[model samples]
Target chain A: MKTPVYISHPGLVTPLGLGVQQNFTEITNGNIAIQKHSRTDIAKEPFYAAMVSEAAINEAFKSHGAISEYTKLEKMMLLSALETLDNSEVKISDKTLLIVATTKGNIDVLDKDSAFNSERAYLPNLAKTLGDFLGVTATPVVISNACVSGILAVAVAKRLISSGGYDNALILSGDLVSRFTLSGFQSFQAISDLPCKPYSKYRNGITLGEAASSVFVSTIKPTQFAVQVLGDGSCNDANHISGPSRTGEGLFKSVQDAMKEAKIDAHEVDFISAHGTATIYNDEMEAIAFNRAALHGSLLHSLKGIFGHTLGASGLLETVIALEMMKQELILPSTGFDTLGVSKPLAIVETIKHQPINILLKTASGFGGCNTAVVFKKVS
Target chain B: MRNGALFAEIDAANFEGFLKQLYVMLDCKYPKFFKMDTLSKLAFMGAELLLSEISENSSEHKRTALVFSNRSSSLETDRKHQEAISSHGEQYPSPAVFVYTLPNIGVGEVAIRHKLQTENAFFVFETFEPEFLQKYTVSLLNENKCDQVLCGWVEVDGNERHGFFYVVGRNGKWKHSAATIKNFFEHD
Candidate 1:
């Protein structure tokens, strides 16, 4: 029999709040964090984004280390990972692996007036900084596959631990809403003018968000609220460089493979945490993929409406929230969703439904035509 | 260049020119080759050289995975995107340049070329960690995730470029181990 991996101690630092419980509370209370930001330094015109409060991050980071010494993304990652470390019995050692996931780390360092050296923009250096902060002896592995980096980190951790390469894995994922990403998204004309309404006909585009989330995966199970990493699949659309597949071919195959490995059928999945960025093509693509996987009737929700699109952090942050929902037996509504917009039908959670979520599917798709689906089961 | 015999060499003035010369020598007909950044071009060429030797069965292609690592993490293309939006330049970032900012686009390019939709991951490290790569790839094969894996270190930063790619399968002549992989990464 293969070794089973268990996940616990979810850590989060998002615009809603710090720590998993705080963010969960905010989401449960119908709070949305995406708002108008008129920062001239990041963009020429005002844009809507979910930004973590600098003051809050500094205040919470005071007990950890010097605030100014670390970059903004570093501070978020450090705080989130420290939460998981503080709560879990797992220790950072040679036997433990650290995986850092992000699209752009310390990207602000490339700005003309940045305080840090430009070399900090390199992902390996950024990961090493986090590893050094946490006193990890083994070389940290970094994943930078666009938005799927966060959830893909979980899948990587599961594989590494199952391979007996490590006793425990601490997965930390973070990204920033900096001038680089904001300008890039603006260039694509993909930034939503309003808070994104995923799967709604009136939805315009994605609302960029920034946050960091961490989770610990190990063979040892926590005393309470532990979830088993059943199976995972990541596949490329192999069709486009930047756009998702029009037919949702990659996502369909990913979900099918993941479920096949989990030895479960579509009817067994109680809920799905979807990657609904509210863009027209993305939502439509997801609808088709879910329908193709025979998951049209599965209860689904997108966390983007609450936290916006956290980029690298979105997948893990949303997964963390899904775990909490499983424990609480409450399925949060897909905020900002009104009418079904996609061609196929999706059982979008329109209201809070208190139901036992045994098996859940978490999926994320991103640039480079990458899609990842991971199946998790609540350990009773 | 087969078996390190140096069968061909191109005397070009610049890196791009050298890549173009190599493309012509290989007689590649793919029109999309011209649009890729330096990193993608290098990865595509390396993959072409390695994958061309494999069987042409389309069914086997779905069982092939690509695991790549790099040091720079698309910084060369990122520099261009940054410059386009910088105050000293045009201040208009092109979506075409912006799309190639992630390192995995190269992996995506190769996947599109070979129609391999199995598994893909791009890792960044300070240097090539052969042990980690070997362990990760072996686990994937052992777990029945894929039948074959294209693993390598593809790094490109401005004028510096290094690509080492090899296919790992159950029936390879050489044993798939860290030491052997390291030997190829260093000597080959």
Candidate 2:
């Protein structure tokens, strides 16, 4: 028999707070942090984003001990890794395997006017820097598959841990609102004016956000409260990269496959963390998919209203927040959820409620019809 | 905790020619009636040979996985997505071209054609993940997500394209040939 991979530790850095503990404290109380950018080159259209202030980030690094000058992207990764190790009470040693996921891993370095002209690209160098900081022996596996990069990073770590190739694995996924992504979204007109109202009637578009979350996976069982990643399946939509399938068949299949793998009944899921980008077709397609999955009555929420869309980091960060919320036995309120807009709205979680949380279906969809849903259950 | 697993090999030189040989092998295995297109040629060819025996089956093929990794952004479609929005006067951007912008959509193309919806992932890195294949396969199998997970390299270096994959399952028909399993890329 093969070993089962479990999430031994988790850490997150978002608009809410820094480190795993602070993020959890905010999530449980339903503290939403969609703040205005004050000023930017981007239009006032959807100026709201879940921005991790520079001060908080600096403080996080100070808490970690020392810092370096690789790049902000590398710093985000290192900070999250430190928080994860601290929360898990694990040491950063030469034996650990660190996996880094980002679509634009050190792509920000390209904006430095050096990568374009110079042969010194930062991605290859950034991974080495992150690995060196953690004192990891194995070279970090850097994955950058569009939006699914971070989610796939977790999936890859899960696979590695299950194979017992490594005793402990860390997954760090982050993406900021760079001119590349920010402009791309603007080019596609996928941006919204207000903080995205995921399932609200007359919802317009998505607000880009930045986030980084890290989690540790291991074969050792947890002695205390932990969320068991029962099952998850990632697949390409094959429909269209930009336009989701009208049928939501691929998304539907992902949820179905995950439940099947986890040996879970669809109805057993208590809450759904949707990839609610607030786009017209995306939300519509999601509603169709959830209804088809018979998840009509389950509590559903898209924290994008509070955190905005963090792209690659959104899924991992959201999953971490969801698991943290489980610890407090409290569910977060879905922001901008005034009226139910979805054709088949699965009970949109409107207000924060304290309850006996058990199972959660966390899902995300991105470019390439890449949709993934993982069933996490509170280990009994 | 790793389970019994192995690898398969594909020569990554002159991808088009390699794909042609792959097509013949796949056509022989499945005998499909549809004519193939250049767009689906490379991906379909790789997916076909990777799961030669299982590709012919139409039912419950989910247990047979399809995983690929590559760094070359889909330049073919990437260029097309760029060209279409610029050229088309009234038509919305060609969704078809915009679709393949991601390297992993190749996995979707194969999954839909083979109807193998079991377990799949598109991994991207600067270079080969070296040992992630066997490691990931064991995890998926142990988790009972797939009967046998397939994984390999799928990239377009230049005018050339390359990809390789093999199914991994525990069938005791053959002996535990550690030598063969270890030397797959060399001889298989």
Candidate 3:
């Protein structure tokens, strides 16, 4: 028999707030954190983004006096992981693995006029630093699989713990809103001028965001409300390098694979945490995929409107939010969604529907034509 | 049991030429390869080198998982993108260069080339972890997540590139064990 993996001790640091209670309250109240910023470092023109303020990070780190050696990205990840680990009984020893997921780590160190050595910008260095801070002796595993990195990390951790002798694994996902990332989105013309309207008729593009989220997947359940890691799958579109498949073939296959592994039918999925980046092609593609998969009846919402597209952190952050939403029995509205946008129809969660949400499916697709789907069951 | 194996290393001076030479040697005509960034190019070359002979009749191409890793994580392309912006101005960040900034683009490149739409992922470790790679692949294969795996480390630092790729399949010649993976990874 396969080992059961349960998710517990969720910790998140986003523009919405810190911890589950604060962010959940703010998001449930329909308070989105995205705002227009004219920072010269990011861009000369104003850009909309959900960014965690430096003051907030500094304030959060005030309790840790000996953190001068860590970079801003490392600090954010460490803080998020610490919060989650604090509530857990699992020891961070050789038996416990640390999986750090990010699209870019310490990327700012590569900018011109920066004093830090460029090697420090490597992802492994960032992972090692955070793992060391978490008191892990084993070498850390870093996942940099574009936007899917966050959710994929959880899947990897689940498999590792289930198949190996490890009893616990911590999966942390993070990315920063740096000048490099912002300008890259701008270059692609995929940056929305206003708050991102995911799955909306007027949706333009993604609003870049930054945050760090952590989840502890253990063989032993730690809480009554622990979420079960049902099954997961990842597939490549094999169609384009930067664009998603026009047919959503990768996404369709990913959902099919995940559902097959979860041993659940499409009708059993009570709700879905869609990627819903709000871009025209991406939303259309997802709608087609869901419809093709016969998931037309599943209530679905995207947290991108509230958190923006958190990139590497989006999958895990959205999963964490989905767990909280399930715990509170609140179907938070897909903020910024006004009218149906895609060609295929979807039961997009428009209002705060207070319905029982169990057996949730979270899906994410990224630039490299990568698509990932993970199934989670709410523990009663 | 394994059908074929090959390893290739490229230096900065002959990187482009080496790719072209290998492309002709393998008689490949994929035009999109020329557009890939250095990271993708190196990974694609490694995949081609290992799977050139054996992957021909494998109907389960879609079932082949790519377990790739690197330490640099696209720093070379990052530097180029940064150079493009700095050398040009603040208003000009090349989207083409910007797209390759992430390290997993290498996995995507290999997937697109080989039409591998399976359980693909790119990990960044401090160094190559042969045991971890072998264990992860074996677990996935045992779980029936994938039928075959193309796993290895493809690290590109500046002009120098080193790649070690292995095609592990069920009912193959080589055993998919940790020690065998370490041997193959460290061989040549």
TM-score of chain A of each: 0.98, 0.91, 0.97
CAPRI quality level assigned to candidate 2 from its DockQ score:
acceptable
The candidate maximizing lDDT is: 1
What are the models' TM-scores?
A: 0.98, 0.80, 0.96
- Name the regions of candidate 2 deviating beyond 4 angstroms: A1-4, A24-33, A36-48, A62-68, A90-95, A112-125, B1-45, B48-55, B58-63, B71-101, B157-161, B167-188
Give Cα-based local distance difference scores for all models: 0.89, 0.67, 0.84
Comparison by TM-score, 1 against 3, better one: 1
The reply for model 3, stretches above 4 Å from the true place, is A113-115, B1-13, B55-57, B88-91
Going through the candidates in order, their DockQ values are: 0.81, 0.25, 0.74
lDDT of 3 at A301: 92
lDDT of 1 by residue, A1-380 (tens): 88999988889999988998898888778788888999988887898999999899999999889998999889999999988988586666679888999988888898878889999999999999999999999999999998899999988888889988789899999989988888898889998888999999999899989999999989997776779999999999998888889999889988998898899999999999999999999999999999999999999999898888888888999999899999999999999999889999999999899899999999999887899999999987
DockQ versus reference, model 3? 0.74
Write model 3 residue lDDT over A1-380, tens digit each, in one string: 89888888889999887787899889877799899888876677888999888677778887874555667777777778878988586566678888899998788888775556777788888888787677788888899999999999988888888897477888889998888888788889999889999888999999988899998898877656768899888999988888999899999998998999899999999999999999999999999999999998999999999989989999999999898888888889889999898998899988898888889999999978899999999876
User: What clash pairs does model 2 have?
Assistant: A46-A193, A237-A369, B62-B118
What does candidate 2's lDDT look like per residue over A322-369, in tens digits?
877787788888887788787885788877888867998988887756
Off by over 4 Å in 1: none
Per-residue accuracy of model 1 over B1-188 as CA lDDT, tens digit each: 54455747789998778788888888888889899998899889888887887886844456888899999999989888888878654468989899899999998999888887778999999999998898889888877879899886889986678888888988868998999988878886
